[model samples]
Target chain A: MTSSKILPAMPLLAAGLVATPALAASVTITIPQVKVAEYHRPYVAGWLEPVGGGSARTVFVWYDVKKGGREPGTKWLADLRSWWRKGGNTMKLPANGVSGATRAPGSYTVPIPANLPAGQYVFKVEAARETGGRELVSVPFSVPAKGGSASGKTELGTITIR
Target chain B: MRFRTVLIAAAAASSALATPAMAHRQWLLPSTTTLAGTSEYVTVDAAVSNDLFYPDHVALDPAAVKVWAPDGSEGKVENPSKGRYRGTFDVAIDKPGTWKIGMERSMIGGTFKLNGEQWRVGGRRPPMAPGAARPSGAAPAGAAPAGAAPARAPGAPGSAGGQAGGQPMRMVASVAEIPAGATEVKLTESLSTYAIYVSADAPTKGVLTPTGKGLEFDPVTHPDALVSDEEAQFRFLVDGKPAAGVKVTLVPGGKKYREAEHAQELTTGADGMVRVKWPVAGMYWMSATTEDAKPSDKRASARRMTFGSTLEVVAP
Candidate 1:
């Protein structure tokens, strides 16, 4: 079953033009609607980390960027524990193509970092909501190759990397 | 030494079960557990109370509390104040990662002979010099209440005797004050520590490393990163090694509004690990105690250790 999915990317692998624009990958993430008395849009973070664990490359983050409080919405970014521990805490917020406002319940597509070297990576999508639960879904996919998908049961839904 | 270890372990197990009902709970409650910034500051409340986190009993001395930065260097607290019920202080988190704030106290107590009467010494009293006469007309400060003190009969030093009501036994300054040729000399030292963790950015483990003495928390999961519905593994250690069969208890805050204590009692596995599963996001007070034969001071025959920490668990 797995080999069938990889066959389509075999030609590009054989040609060794893996870094071409045609091979650029994107991830599709779904934010599930959580029912609660006080529902706040879940803060989401999408990043690709090495399969064996190393530095992480963040694809995008959806958070409260423009709150009028003395401290910005980034104050609660630590609620996304896994991402924060994996170098998210060190990031300078509002980075280009990496930071965005929180999205309502829906699905969105985000482009992966171009020029990523060939290697096994796990694309992780984590969502944490106020007055609700948190969930993380990981899709293992290699750069310059086929895609994979995984689903979360709570705050996050389907996550696909292609 | 082997037989003594077994004997102390047995005594500790029984005493651990009996302590909670009679002794007050001490904790340091941090204002916030996690943060994200170049730096942040957290204010903490320290108190001893019947209910967890409730400050109705007595205020802990703010000067006794200490702070350790993430780098394991000593940190400082600001604006310390002691009210009737509790004490408060602020810690500046100029450095990133986790920080520790709490108290560490050690005391030695023993049985001795003064004027042919067997007396006990302990608590916060200063050690008495050897060959010195017991102080006259100076009653011991902080004497245990009548029923609380371990009653001992005169000349029956080694046996754990039954209670005798009245103004509790006189506590001499130390075993050194015992007259020459005194028999059944026994000295025990105790170390007690209480702490809470706060993270300015991501959590770090340097401050969580155990000092290889007494009962300590060796968190398999980072203390500042705990959340509800997730299982956090914690290991209890004695003398830097895994301490097995110790009893650990977790009592949530807001006991004033609750009907029962709702504490979770658990025992450490052979590996000294306890998997804690929180039912909800809140502040929890954790406590564990153990007695062992390892005494750092050669003058002490046995050692007792107590560990306590206030942990905040957040919603997922």
Candidate 2:
């Protein structure tokens, strides 16, 4: 039974990759006017999720989790629950692959995977205050057999992300 | 073929059942004590109970270590030399007072699984000066000076006569004088945690003074009200210029949601002061708007002016 199941499943799994595109794909998220007061910069998280279900995979994370000596733990990563449960929760280091420094209110861009599977995908942008509220902004995009680019925006009230 | 299949299934079942139960036990370990008032070295050791249980070659995640000096100064240890399934850190202590060392371990990789835990390195009692007799005065060995009660040492034994448990060692006591006209505020008593004291007045600002060891401030933003009393007396400057009648809004950080509901909004006073009582502790982002203000002619005018500082309030 196992041999029969494996023999048929392997071809289907291999065929599933036929829809993947080989173009340089990218998604840029811009948040404008992030207000930095009291030396506290904004913490931002970016990720991609399947259109309907499954998991959210993080593509970027930015924050100053270190003070003079205090370190931010993986537990704190849970603060970005939507991203943590999807992508960060499974990786050895959340900072690896998708890490950026905490930035003042301004425009920032992240490159998406060029080899993303062709499908309807949702891009999520979530910004949290180290000392304030959380805002989750999402934009939907599609990856064709040929990869391309997509963009989105979120207004954080004196803060903007495009 | 059927017989071979049955045999393979039996072997698989036995192998699964025979798998060993493994426990990972990696903990932060530091020297028991260091001589006070000398160039004494204190070492932090990370050890695992069993080599088979060791997860990975331990390395100090530079951001995880917080070291506080006797004089209130703080510094972080960023690098750790790797040992066989362990890590060792040698630190220099140059003053007399309690030195607090705190560390957290991360489980990077391996078959054994261990969740991270914060561990303190030093004992409660300060390392006594070599050959110095216990104070001859009537005070107890660990008692604070007259008119001041000594803060309880971390991990200290419950009773005075309790058996000397292997708690982390601390340094000898040193005088922490609240500068003239400054009131001492008692923050939390946890080791390596912030214990802040400030002057009891409006526009209060003071710096921590470390006696010997260097002090480093936590860059992470603390709750805003932690520094000032609620109903803060704020001074507003727009574009580096004092502006009156400016509409201002204070936005709290995401972590500060609990306190955001209570943060007050105020207009700049005639003197550019915006006083509002803070209802909770957290980070706040204040934005002031001036209707018709133009860019200043001065070179400094081009610079954007915004207050970015963390405030911490401690118990008195």
Most accurate candidate by lDDT = 1
- Model 2 is docked with a DockQ of 0.01
How far off is residue B24 in model 2, in Å?
A: 42
The per-model lDDT (C-alpha) reads 0.74, 0.40
- Pairing residues by index, what is the TM-score of model 2? 0.28
Candidate 1 residue B255 Cα shift, in angstroms, is 4.1
**Model 2: per-residue Cα lDDT over B1-316, one tens digit each:** 5544433333222221111121222234444332312334566654333221132533323244567665557744545666544566655654444355553111111111112212211123333334443312223445545224234332221112111233322222222211122122221111111221211111112232222221122211222123334345555444344557655555443432243234345667676666655544443434333433132222111112222222333211
What TM-scores do the predictions have?
Answer: 0.70, 0.28
Report the C-alpha lDDT of model 1 over A1-162, residue by residue, as the tens digit.
Answer: 011111223343476555646347877788877777799998999888988768998888888877745576887898788788676877888676678888888777776776888888999988989778778888999877668999999888888777
List each model's interface RMSD: 2.8, 19.1
Top-scoring candidate (TM-score): 1
